[model samples]
Each structure stands twice: as C-alpha cells, then as structure tokens.
Target: MPVRRRRSTALAAAVATATTLGATALAALGGATTASAAEAPLADYELTWGIKQSYRTYVGMFGSFTASEGAGQAPGSGAFTFTDGTGTYDTTAHTVDLAFRGRLVSASAAHHFEVTLTDLRFDSGAGEITADVTTVDTSGATPTKKGDDVPLAKVAVTRTMTDMATTLTTEAGEYLGSDGYAGAAGDPLTVVKKTPPTTEPTTGPTPGPTGEPTTGEPSKEPTTDPEPTDPQTTPATREPSPTASTSAAPSAPATTAPATTAPTKGEIADGTLGWGVKESFRAYVVGTVAKGRVTVSGGATQSAGNGAFTFKDATGTYDTDADKLTATFKGAVNFKGHESGGSYGLDLTLSNLKATLDGGTGTLSADVNSLGTQTKGVVLADLEAKSGDLKAAQDVVTVDDVAATLTAAGAKAFGDFYRAGTALDTVDLSVALSDDARLPDGGGSDTSGGTSGGSGTAGGSTGGGTGTAGGTGSTVGGTGTTTGGSLGGGSLASTGSDIPGPALGAAAGAAVVVGAGAVYAARRRRTQGRSAE
Candidate 1:
C-alpha cells in the first residue's frame, strides 16, 4: 500500500510540472505576437492639405499697325492677377476658393474684370480647376484707337496636390509622417460665401398729379402771382403748393428686375477613352477602329476633330483639344490596378506615353503617315497595340493581331515594312539567280540534295557484307572470284589466265569422284592389298 501511494504521488507531480511549463510557453508566445504587431510599420495614412498660389500674365500683340495707325483692335498691353485660397484635400472630398482681377495696362484702353468664388468642390476629379470671365465691367472710360483694352475671352489654370503618403513611411506608433502634412504658404483658411446675383432697381419719372401732366411745361401757373403780395405774407403764413403735395404721393415704388444667375464655376463631368483606345486610337473596346464618337454634358465641347476625342471603356470620353471644356460627372472614374481615387488623364500614346491619375498633367503627339505625296495624320500619336489573349481592365475587350493590322498604304503601319521607304533607298540592285537554287537549312545542310536522289535500294548489308548472288551457288568471294571457279578452264576463269594450284586441285578431285566413284574405290582396295603383302 505504501509503494502504490508513492508512485501515484510522483505521477501527479510530473503532470503539475508539465502544466506549469506549458502555461509559461503560451504566455511567452502571446508576448511575441503583441511585440510584432506593435513593431510593424504602418501601411499608410490620410491627410488634409491646402495650397494658395498667385499668378500674373502678360500678353503681347503685334501687327502692322501702331497706336497712330489703329489697324488692330487692342494692339496694346494687358495685365492680370489671380489668387486661389487654401482648400481641403483628404481621401473623401476636395474643396478650394479661386478669385481673379484684371486691369488694362495700356492707356489706350481702360479695362476692368472681376470673378469671385462661392464654393468649389472636385469630387469626380475628372476635369481641371479653371475660371472664366465673360462680361467685363467697362463702367469707366472707353479706350481710344490703339490703346483699346482687349477683353479676355477666358483664363484657365489647373492645379493638383497629391497625397505624398504613398511614397512616404511613418514610425510604427506614429499616426502620420511629417511629410504627410501639407499647408499653404500663409496657412490661409478657407472662407465659404453665398454668391447670388445682384438685383437692380428700376426708376420712374415724377408726375405733377394723379391726372396732371408731368411734361416740359407746367400744366397750371400759379393761379395768381400771389396777387402782388407784399414781401411778407399778408397773413404771415403761405399755403403749401399743389405740386408739392402731388410729389409726396409715394414716389412710385421702384421695381427691381429679377437677377439672372451665371452658370456654376468649375463644373466638370467624368469621362473615358474606352478600352484599347486608351493606348491607341486604333479601335474601340469591341475591336473596331474608333469611329471618333464623343458625348459630353455639363457644358462641354469637343476640342479637336481627329484623335483628340476618344472613349476608353464605357465610362466617358475626354476632348483634350477643346478649350475651356467642363463636365459634371455622375460618379467617380475608377481605374484598374490603382487604389487611390481621383480623376486621371487618359493621355496615353504609343511611345513614352503615361496614364496619369490623381489629376496629373502630360503631353502627347500626333502620328502621321505618308501616301505617295500626301500625308495622313492621326491626332492621337501615342497609340499601342496589345498582343496575346489578355483582356483589358474596365470590361474592355482584347484586340487581336488581325484587327490591328495596317497595310502599307494605311494610315499607320507597324513592323519592318513601316520603314520600307528608307530601306528601298539603300538597297542593292545587282544579284544572280540559279536554276536549281536552294536555301541552306538551319542545320547547315543542302536539303535539295536529298530530294534529287530518286528512290533506290541500298547495296550494302547492315553487317557490312555484300548482297546474295543471283544463283544458288556460293556467294562471290572476297578476292573477287566465283564459287564454281575453274581448275584450268572452268566457267568462272578468264581466258589465258593461270589458275591457282590448290584451288585447281580441289575442283579436279571433286569432279573425278562424281564421274568414277566405283572405279576409284576398286583401285584403292587393290592398292591396299598390295601394301599389306
């Protein structure tokens, strides 16, 4: 009984030790996981930024006319200044304030212009931020001949502030990096204002009385010139004139005309240059040459007729050629492979072309082809063709090699023939031809040689021996002799040639045995008896 109790106690102690060790190990693992999480770097952070910029413009016009000649309308100088207040920029929304003022620099003309902003929000990020000044306040003096001020048709300026956090890193525990923060030069705060059209009051002429004429001459003269009244009123009191009483009749209430509101500022729509058209103006998302279809709303206009206007996928099209184009998008423009959200320019071309999202700027050239003496030009220069069976993002169809093929005289050509004109100029004119000409196979052998040899049997055997003879005799010997060779004048011997002695004897013995076997046997027996005696 005592030994059993001791064994039980030892087992219990072992279990307790194991339990304690496991708890310690589990606690250590938990601590390690927590440390790793705390030490891990932050992926990214969101920030609100603001920017304020000032710009000055100088325009010069030259012609054959001078101030005295008065040939040009406004051949003088003009100056303008623009100021944009700070705006908020976060992942969600972007807002800013824009203002402008312009004055005629030359004395020949007097000019004045002003544009104010109430609230500008860029949610879709499709088009750029711009200002347009239509009516100039020429309330002051007008310009003479050469010094006339030229009214500005419109002024457009685009600005973009990017989220630097994508390229920046922050401490493990820090909320955001230092470079993540952005502010304007003066740290100016945004001011929101209500901008409504100004109302004008209408004026009316005064009347003499309800029924009296308000014309050039008075309707009635003073009934009597005060009957030659003395300098002082006879009664020390004068009655109020009828005309004065009539003028007091609530001078007709001024009527104000309803104010006409101008169109909203910086309103733009989101658009796309559908599918493969993004890289090249070659085809639509359906693999057909883009028919140059462009649809725009929110007061937008096409800039150029050629390649400038195109569709990418089904979203919308941008007419970069249009000046001062604006559109209001119903939804945000989504791009493939990019997480950041904003309107991006589809300014892609064939070579060195880049698609810029986040409201970036880039330039593209036009592609031109020559036919005889005429040149056909493609407005969209940077066009690319995709090979293989990879579909484009945004539900854009893949363009096959056949659909993108261009002939030598087509508007655009690719591959070796694209530059054939230059090659033709430097080509050699002299060369010789052969009747049985053949190209060397890649293995460095004349393939034509094998074809020239007609079908025939191989003479040599696989074991390096000659083939069988025609008859049932032995095969022709290695020494070029037949099996049934001659002893002296046999069938196989050459005329006048000596036969070999050993070969000749063997043949003669074989022939004699066949002709006289019995006779030879009798003779041999007799010879044996004689020898025995």
Candidate 2:
C-alpha cells in the first residue's frame, strides 16, 4: 500500500505540471497575435501633369484713301506666366494662376511682331512640365483696308503644340523618407516594421523502429526554458545603406519599396484643327495641300480639287495680337464663268489678302485677278466691271412682283372693253410707255394707239326738204288751155308773134313755170337721207 500511494502521488504531480505548462503556452500565443496586429503595412505610390495656353489682339485701318496708301498695319505680342503647377497624391483638386502682358510690336504699314510665353509651368506629379496654349481675343477690333470694312475675310486660329511633351522623375522617398520631410511641422515621418511570426517547439511521441507503440514509461516531459527575466535585448540595428539594404536589422524596419511614379514622355503628332464655328464667308479655312491635291475644311463646304494652275505650299502665322490672319497662296487659280453666249477665264491671285475674325464671323480682302489672261472662247477682263458688282444685290425687283403688275394691267384693259360693249373678237392690246421709259438719248415718240378691224356703224340727222310739180298741160290742149290764160292775162298770146305785148308776156311766163316745175320734181325723186360721220 505504501508503494502504491507513492506512485499515485507522483502521477498527480505530473498532471498538475502538464496543466500549468499548457496555460503558459496559451498566454504566449495570445501575445504573438497582439504584436502581429500592431505591425504596419508597406506603402507604394505615382505622379502625372496637365498644361494650358491662350492669345489675344486688335487691328484696323487708319487713314484717308488719297493719302499714304490709306491703310495701316498694327501688330503686337503678349506673354503669360503660370506657377505651383504640380501634381498631388490622395486625389486633391488644385489650381494655378496665370498672368498676361501685351507688347505692341509694330504700329506701321509694314508690320512685324513676335509673341513669347514666359516661365509657364506644367504641374504634373512626378515633376513633369508641359504647356498647352490657345489664343483668345478680347479686343473687338477687326481688319479693314482703305477705311472700308471688306466682307468675307476673317480668321481666328487656335494652335496646340501637342508635340511639346515632357517628363519628370522624382526620387521615390524624397518627400516621405525616414528622417526626411514629414511634410509639416511637429509631425515626424515614422517607419514601423512588422514583427515576424512566432513558432512554438512542437511536442510528439517517439516512435520505435518496428512502427509499433512500445512506450515503456512515457518519456520525461520536455520543459520550456523560462523567458529571460532580464528584458530581452533587441538585435543591434545597422544604418540602412544609402542604396537599398540587403542585411536584415532589428532597429531599422525594412523600407516599404517606393512604387515607381515616373512621368511618361507622351508621343506627339499633329493635332486636329478645331474651328469655333462652321466656316462662313468670314470664317477661317483649315486644310492641307499636297502634290496637286488640296483637302480643305472650314468653309461652307469641304472641298478637294486637283489640277490647279499654280500650286504652292502656303504657310502663315495667326497673329492674335493683331486679330489678323496673314496667309500667302502662291498658287494660281484658273477659273471660268459662263455668260449669255460665251465663257470667260479668270486668273485669280492672293495679293495682300488679309483675314480677320470677329467672334465667329470671318472677313477677307485681297487684290484678285490683277493679271488677266484669255483662253479658247474665254475672255479675261476686269470681272467686277463687266459683271457690275457681282456681290449679292441688296436691292433688286423680284420675279413674283413683276408678274403681279402685268396681271393687273390686263385685268383693267379687259374691264374697259366689256363696258364699251365691244365684241372681243379682236382686242388690240398695247401698253402705254411711262414717262420714265424714255430712251437713253432722251427724246421718245408715242406709239400707244392700236387699230382693230371689225363690222360696226353710227347714225345722225339733217334738215328735211321736198319739191312739187306744177300742173301739166297737154300740147294738143294748148290752144284750149289758152282760154284760161286769156282770162288770166288780157288775152291768149297768139302762136305766132304780132300779138299784143300783154299777151306775149303771159305766154312767156307760163313757159318759165313749166320748166321750173319739171326741175323740182326731179330734185324730189333723187333726194336720200344723210348719215352722221
């Protein structure tokens, strides 16, 4: 019984020790987890940039036509500066202010000018610098010649130097390195290193060569060495090499490698031309001409034409300071126009052609067709003189109005015929010439009357008159009749002479009466009524 008691006590003591060791192990594991949670994570970061530019001007004509060529050319240049133009991390919005100053390059007829951009900045993180410039005019001045505001010649240009791409690469930790800038006062940059995982020595049963469980007395429990009571000394730390460090150290945390934030030098090519508005007569024309082909955009229509009489590559700068676009087209233009019975050839040139842009409007002026030529059936002459102001007419009678007037005149003439009761078989119509319709020579004759042949008549009256015949006497009864005369006249006149004077007189008078009576009868029978003329 004594020996058995002693063995039991020993077993109890071993159980107590095993339980205490397990509790200690659990506490150490908890501590390791807490230390891991406090460790810091590595940080990696990049920087990027943007640029903008602009221009402005004023230009106009200055004198009288008769004196000093009548036109003045004014040219000027300007500069602008921008600064802090830098990139930021953590998605922050920022702005840079720009300043502009203008200089009058020339104020004479022969104009010369130059514009410069001073100390412009491009704020691209990673330290990149670039510029994007555009010209804007606040001045309302425009281009004119001889005090005349010529129409259809205005030009505004916005040019971008897309090829002006640049890049910048800053040392990775320059701004946030340990012992380096902390960015602001009182806040020192601190780098924390993560703790490595702690592993416990594993416990397991020993196996016999026969692969059988031959545990005689359980092997003695292994005792973990007590953690040193003296505070454990951390490993000595070595300074990190100026270059990247390869050796591991306790005091110095391994650096969180900086991510590369290098700015890329952008590849630059020609940029597309953007006209503020659809080109009108007074809008800028953007295009390229090569070989014999010209591709142009920006006018009312986009056109491509070949076989130009004169072909030359043209280049000119847009002076925003002068609000003028000066271009020289060295190519010759062969144009033909069809008129009534013939066609005319025109040789057009660009002599002193100046363009101005007013807002969205454009105006151009130049001496065209200075030298004329003729081709087969084509006459070359002063086009403006022959065509009489080919410019769109501001005042001209419309076809519709002229037709209305003729219709009204016909209606009036027809009404007059209807009131006159005239059979409209043949209406001779004629237009009376207005006083203004005189010939160029001044004097003019009236030919307004029109004659028409038709059947018609009119009537009128005259005083009425009649004649009567005296009573007739037969020759055989002459002698008997003489008795009546005898009663009337003293006695009848004898057939022969020797009668008394009174008797002779009575016979002669009777003869006269007979003759008169016969003539009256004849007149009465021949009479017919007269008609009015």
Candidate 3:
C-alpha cells in the first residue's frame, strides 16, 4: 500500500507541471497576437535648403538667393532659414509640403535675377529622394535658357529618429531652379524628430462666402438660385480680400466656366484635330512608355507620293457647348514580331471623326470600319483580305461630361481603348515616313450605303462585284462599312476561316497566324469590358 501511494503522488506532480507549462505558453501566444494587432507609431520628417548666385549674360546681369524648408509626411514639423553671401530667404513663414524647396525668379524689379534647379538627391533613409527640376516661366522677359544639367545646389542630409537614423550625401550638381529653389552648391542639413502627429479630429471647414454653409454635408436648407451671369465676368466667391471695403456687394456664387461650344459639323480645322491627336498620344506615352518595353516616334505626317509616306497624325478639338470632341488620327503602328524575325506595320487613316465625352472621362471613344491597303507590306492587308470589313476602335479624347451622341456608334466603341490601363491595346512603334500619303479620293474609304464595298489593286479598276481572294475584279468594302461576305462558308467574323486566297497571298499561312492574334486581342478586350461592367 505504501509503494502504491508514492507512485500516485509522483504521477500527480508530473501532470501539474505539464498543465502549468501549457497554460503559460497559451497566454504568451495570446499576448503576441494582441501586440501585433496594435498600430505602429507614425514617423515624421522635414528637409531644408537654400541657394544664391549672380551671373552676366548677353542680355544683362542677374543676382538672387533663396532659403526654404518643408515638413515631411505627417507628425514632424520645423523650419529652416538660409542666409549667406546669397541674400536671406526664409520660407519658414510660407507654406511647406513634404519637401523643402523653393523657386526664385527674376524679381519684378530685377530682370537679370533668375534661378534653376539642376540636380538634387538624398541617400537612403534620408527619405530616398532623387529628382531633377527645371524652370517654368509663363510670362516675363523670358531669360535665355541655359543648360539644365548645371548643378545649382548640393546638400548632405542626416535624419535621426529615436529608434533609427540615416545620413544621405549627394554629389554637387547644377541647380535648375527655373522651377524655383533656394540652396547652395553644397550644404549640410540636419533633421530631428519632434512630436508625433495626433489622431485628434481636424478643425471644421471655415466659412467660404457669405450665406454659404460651413458643414461637411450639403445644406438641406432651401435656397434661391442666383441669376445666370456671364462666365467671363462672374467673380469667384472667395474670402474677401484683406483690402476689401466694409461695404462689399453680395459675392458671386462659385461656378465653373460654361461648357465649350462644339465645332460646327464638318467645320473642325485639320490643325485642331491634329492638336487633339498629339495630346492624346502624348498622354498615352506619358502613362505607358517604359525602357526596353515600348517606344514611339515621328507622329507627324509629311508630304505625299514618296514611295514611303505616312498619313498625318489626327487632331482633336473640343466643343464645350456641344459637349463633343472632333478629332482625326492617321498613322502606322508597328508590332514587334517573333524573336527570330518578321515585323510589320498597321497603316491607319481616320477622318471625319467626332466623339462625345458623355460617357465621362476615359469614355471618349469611336468605332469606325477601317479600309485596308492592298499593299503587300501592310499587316491590315492580311486581315482585310480575309475579313471583308476591318473594325477599328479609337478613343480619341477623354473628358468629363455626359455622352449625348449615340449616333456616333463608332466613337463609342473606341471608349474602352481610351480608358485607363489600356496602353497594351496600343502598339508602340518608331518610324519616319519618307513622304506623305495621298488622302483617299473620298476621305480614305467610303461608308455610303450598307454592304459597304471599295476596291484597290496596284491599279485595279473600281467596280461592284465580289471576286475570289487574289482574283482581279474583287470589290473591297469602303472604310467604316460592314459587309456580309464570308470565306469558306465560315462567318467572316469567326476564327474558323482557314481558306487561302489573295488576301493571305504569299503570306497566307503567316497571315492566318497574325489574323488569329488580332481576333484574339479583340475578343479579349471585349471580355474585359464585360467583366468591368
């Protein structure tokens, strides 16, 4: 009996120890999880800089110096003052964003004084900054521009936080302050952390104009509508200027400029259209261009009849009142072919283009049937020769408004092409047309009656009869027209047509592969559109 009691006690002690250890581990794990769910403390930072310089040019001599500093993303705040051989400039009194920089231009009284920022950089943890700034002077006796590559100011910055610190050193470079800046050729800046940003509620909005509400929500109170006034003459409802007299007339309500009037039908100048095209292309390039991925060049059109010619880039002009945009684009987009070889171009000619931005921003689109060149070198030829009608969706301009013109069904189709993140829909290219292309006899293809048909060969006669592929006398569809013709009993729109004909020609097999790609792209785009909806 005694032996049994001793064994029992030993077992109970072992169980008790195991239970304690398990409970301790569970508690520790719970504490870790809770700590992880807590928010991290925010870090605040600031930067300060200054500059001074005097120089002579063919025009005259100029001199100036400026100082500025800015607070960093939330929680940190401070000011930097600059004074040296250069004049004193303290931007601490002025508003500073997350960056500390300033722009100094020729003082109104001094024509020679101008500044530029050439090069600026910061090391890791010094906010990891790298930027090159230039000048933007809208008015004044514009100073002759010097090379922007000159280093105007250089600085070494050290950022020290309670838990961590970093120092950044930069090479001396030009100060291209055309944009505005105050800093020396080289300087040292020290930044220290202070109080953290608070989570307190921000102050409420200040009163805008007399009678205007100062609350977050629009007032439910009934109000009388102000009489319409000339947009150009309408004064903005701003806080009364400091110099305002005690007896001021009622303030005008804030309002947007009236929508622009649309161009008269068929009245848009080619130049206006060209400008719009250039703007659209520039916008696309800005958003899409990247190294080793895509490149674009020579978007302008030159003179015609030269064996190698290109059509002019399209132009666009907005009609605010009409809430419509008129534009035209004609050019070639080249696609990189297989790794081994083979590359080609898609020659496009768009005219008489009008679009309604009614779909709002990014919905300014156009759908138009395209005419295909019978020329051997063009990729559109392969598709056109196979499909009776070539379809095109070109979103020309993006603006905010209501789309009212559904009649321009073609334009609506191009809306998706213009929408954001559709750069891949565009084929990037580089080319210089040796000569200009002749405008089509009637606007680069016709879209007269239904069952559209046009014709072309090296010099083939125009007529109204369907001919087998490659067979002379085949009638081609006019631009922007849909035809009901099919090849090999397959719907021309379907991917099953494997028949070889003049359209495919010597490159029939290759055309099949390329045409299939075009079809796939079109289908994928449509799918994406549906999914978005």
Q: Pick the candidate with the highest TM-score.
A: 3
* Cα-based TM-score, every candidate: 0.13, 0.13, 0.21
Could you tell me how far off, in angstroms, the CA of residue 166 lies in candidate 2 after the best superposition? 24
Candidate-wise lDDT, in order = 0.20, 0.18, 0.23
How well is each residue in 1-533 modelled by candidate 3, as lDDT tens digits?
Answer: 00111122222222333344465653563533422332121123333332211111100111122333221211100122211111110111111112223332322112222333322222221233333334323233344445422333333322221112221222211223211112212223432222222311111122222221122112321121110111111223222433374444233111212323222333333321111221122111111110001111234232111011122444554443343444444443221111112321211233333222321222223222222321121111000011112111121122211212122222223322222222111111111111121222111221111111111221111111112222221111101112333332111222222121211223323433344335323543454343222
Backbone clash numbers for all candidates listed: 21, 21, 58
lDDT of 3: 0.23
Q: What's the CA error at residue 230 for candidate 2, in Å?
A: 57
TM-score of 2: 0.13
Candidate 3 Cα misplacement greater than 4 A, ranges: 1-266, 272-320, 335-338, 341-355, 359-533
Rank order by lDDT, top first?
3, 1, 2
- List, residue by residue over 502-522, the lDDT tens digit for candidate 2: 212333335423332232223
**Which sections of candidate 1 miss by over 4 Å?**
1-101, 104-271, 274-308, 313-361, 370-533
**Predicted candidate 1 versus true structure: per-residue lDDT over 1-533, tens digit per residue:** 00111122223222333344565653564533422322211111111212111101000100011121101122111111222222211111111222222211211111122212112222112212222212222233222122111111111212222321111111100111011111111111212221111310111122212111112112221121111122122112323544666776555222211222212222212222211222111111101011112222222112221112222111222222231121111211111110113311111112111221112121122222111111223222222233222221221222221112222322122211122121110000000011121212112121111111111111111111112221110111111122344433222221111111121234333532232222223333343333222
RMSD value for candidate 1:
48.2
